[model samples]
Target chain A: MRAQFVLSEIWIGLRRNLTMTIAVIVTVAISLALFGSGLLINRQVDQMRGFWEGRIQVTIYLCNEVSANPQCQENGPPTEEQRAQIQTDLEAMPQVESVTYESAEEAWQHFSERFESNPALVDAADPEDLPESFRVALHNPQDFNQVASAFEGAPGVDNVYDERQILNRFFDLLSGLQNAAFIVALVQIVAAALLIGNTIRLSAYSRRRETGIMRLVGASNFYIQLPFLLEGAIAGLIGGIVGSIFIVAAKFLLLDGMQDYFQFATTLPISELIYVILLSIVLGVLLCSLASFISLRRYLRV
Target chain B: MVGSDTRHHNLREHAPVINFDNVTKRYPTQKRPALEDVSIQVEKGEFLFLVGPSGSGKSTFLRLVLKEERPNDGRIHVAGKDLARLSNWKVPHLRRRIGCVFQDFRLLPNKDVFENVAFALEVIGKPRRFIRKVVPEVVELVGLEGKADRMPDELSGGEQQRVAIARAFVNRPMILLADEPTGNIDPATSIGIMKVLDRINRTGTTVVMATHDAAIVDSMRKRVVELEEGKVVRDQSRGVYGQAY
Candidate 1:
């Protein structure tokens, strides 16, 4: 029966301050959505790193007659002895997990297959024109720097390249995006907290008379505050539901929409989406309750 | 002091509902204490009038009894519990045993007469079945049985006061405190309010009232404690409002 009274009080408070209540709901929804997006992006970056780190290799391109690299001028099409020596040194390095020697013919065939759709580029290339190289895979992909420095300026090597370096730049962009989203979400959360505080203060002020009577009638502090706390929690719950909807819409329209185009990068799974939604809802409810509690402490004596 | 203690002991045997022993209350912003070393005792089932001028500390006396404010220099015991010894958490329990009515009739404007009265029981977590049974009885006691559905704004000033009284008494408190409850209504309506209070007191509930209603005070002929400039100037059993002037 008392719960019924408190529920009715909460309803009356919300109805009386409908505009402010809506403002709180919308603010919390937008902030939680941004927060959820930030978490999702972090998850995506981790997944992409897991997918790419294993396959990334450091390529040591040996000098060839067609190579314009300065190292090739002194070597003159790289003697077989020089190539064998370079291959032996790469294999002996502790940073090198394993090295595969790709001859010019094999390099040409791999290149042709990669550009199979672009016949014009494949026709311009000759088997003898491709540089022979060693493809070195490190046990730890981050050891690319150690392997690259070891092979650079070697006798037969024309250029040292780590494929992971390119991928690192891509990941750096993603990390930057994640940080920006988190900052925006943080700002929005602060704004939402302030708005919730103001809304609660206004509600309390407008109902001061009722509270005064409640005090006179022997209402406990908890009894007086329960309705207001529930008011904030209800608004937060609605905001969480809306935010979850936004996250689901974003997953469908943005991530799942591009699933076929970016097959190499794995899409976030359903479990991740569910986790984000639940987290956003919990965060919303806690944020609102905390804000309301603070305002009540500062503004309402009871 | 020894004689007063013996007197208090005798009153305690009679179940003194309120005992104020040299209670003094001073507001920091004021130059003088609101209540100054005033001692009064009210026995159970007594109807007492606290008559005083605008700043004679009548309201302060009621507030101290309610535990709304502490006495700076004395002790008060209500229903056998020492006000100073009462913990903060136990204040609501103290208040639940007492009912208060104000000059403004402090009814929730949005709630109807029945809801306003039922609110008292609801806030204290009374069962729905009990509330359904008691609300109407109290409403009928205040002679507003048919008007229970009317909102505060729709009622006359006297009816509003009746609703306030019903809300206060619905909990069946051991004591009722009225601070100028009839101040806003006409003389005719003030009598009506006093009769309701008198009826509630007849049920063995102690009644303490602070008021400026000279006519009602003279007509009721109850015990009167009058204060002047924060000091008790008169204590008379079956007193008139003033010097019969």
Candidate 2:
């Protein structure tokens, strides 16, 4: 019965401040959506790093007729002995997980397959134009510099290339985007907190007379505050629901919708999306309650 | 009905319901104290009028009893518990035993007469069965029987005050403090409110009313404590308002 009374009071309070309540809901929804998006982006970045970094290899290109390096020109394309020696040295290194030899013809085949979507670029390259190289997989991709330096001045070597260096640049761009999204999310969250506080204050101010009477009638502090706290929680709960819907819609439109176009990119698993939705709801409710509780402490003396 | 309840029989017959000993209260922004060196005792089952001119500490006196403000210099005891020593959390329990009616009638504008009175019980977590039973009884006692469903804006000044009174009395408080309960109503309606208070008092409840209503104070012939500039200048049984001056 008392719960019924408290619930009714919460309804009355929400109804009385309908406009302010909507403002709080919308602010909380937008902020939580941004926060959820940031979290999802962080997860996506980690997944991409895991998938790409595992495949990263340091490539050692042998000197070919078309190679511009002085060392490659002097050696005139690595002799069979030079190629065998380079492969042996790479396999002997402790950091080298494994080495795969890609001959000039194999390199041309891989390049052609990669550029299949751009047939014009594929037809521009001659089969003999590609260089024979040893693709060196490292036990730890972070040890790329050690592998690169080990083969840098080796005979018949045109140049040492760590795929991770280029991948790092791409990941850096993604990380920067994630950071920017997080910063925006943080600002929105702060705005949501302030908005919740202001709304609660206005509601409390408008009901001062009723609260004064409540105080006189001997209502406990908890009893007086329960309705207001519930009001904030309800608003936050609605916001969270809306935010979850937005995140799901975003996933459908941006991630799932691009499935065919970016088949190589990993999509966030359904479980992760569900987790984000649940977390966003919990965060929304907690943030709003905390904001209102602080505001009530400051403004509502009862 | 005085002394009819056997539960209250164990309480000392002459024990004061409210006691103030050399109590002094001052606001932070003001140099002069709102109440200065005031001492008074109100016995249970008595009707006392707190009469004073404007800014004479009448409201402060009632506020002190409510523990809304603490005295700076002295002690105050309500229903035998020292207000100074009471923990802040226990203030609600103290207030539960005392009812208060204000000059403005402080009714919830959105609530009907029934809800306004029932709100007091609802806030205290009274059982629904009890609320259902007690709300109508109190509403009938306040003579707003047919008007229970009327909203505050729909009621006259007198009816609103009666709703406020019913809310105060619903819990059967031992003491009822009226801070100019009849302040906003007309003289005829003020008399009606006074009669309702007198009825409650006769039922063994102590009544302390703060008012500047001379005619009601003169006609009621109750014990009157009059203050002037924070000092209690008169305490008379069957006293008339402005008589001390």
The TM-score leader among the candidates is: 2
Model 1 TM-score on a 0 to 1 scale: 0.90
- lDDT for residue B49 in candidate 1, whole number 0-100: 96
CA deviation > 4 Å runs, candidate 1 = A65-78, A93-95, A120-129, A257-263, B1-16, B71-73, B243-245
Inter-residue clash pairs, candidate 2? none
lDDT, each prediction: 0.89, 0.89
Cα lDDT of model 1 by residue, B89-196, tens digit: 789899999999999999998889988998888888889889889999999998898998999999999999999999999999999999999999999988898999
Question: Residue A164 of model 1: what lDDT?
Answer: 81
Tell me the tens digit of each residue's lDDT in model 2 across B94-146: 99999999998888888899999999988888998899999999999988999
**How many residue-pair clashes does candidate 1 contain?**
0
Model 2 preserves the real interface contacts to a fraction of: 0.68
**Per-residue lDDT of model 1, residues A1-302, tens digit only:** 37778988899899999999999999999989888887887888898899888888889898888778887887777787888888888889887789999998899999999999999998987878888888988888888777778778878788888898787887787688778878988999999999999999999999898888888899898898888888888889999999888888867785666455556558789999999999999999999999999999887784
Alpha carbon deviation, residue A154, candidate 2 (Å): 2.2
TM-score (all chains, Cα) for each model: 0.90, 0.92
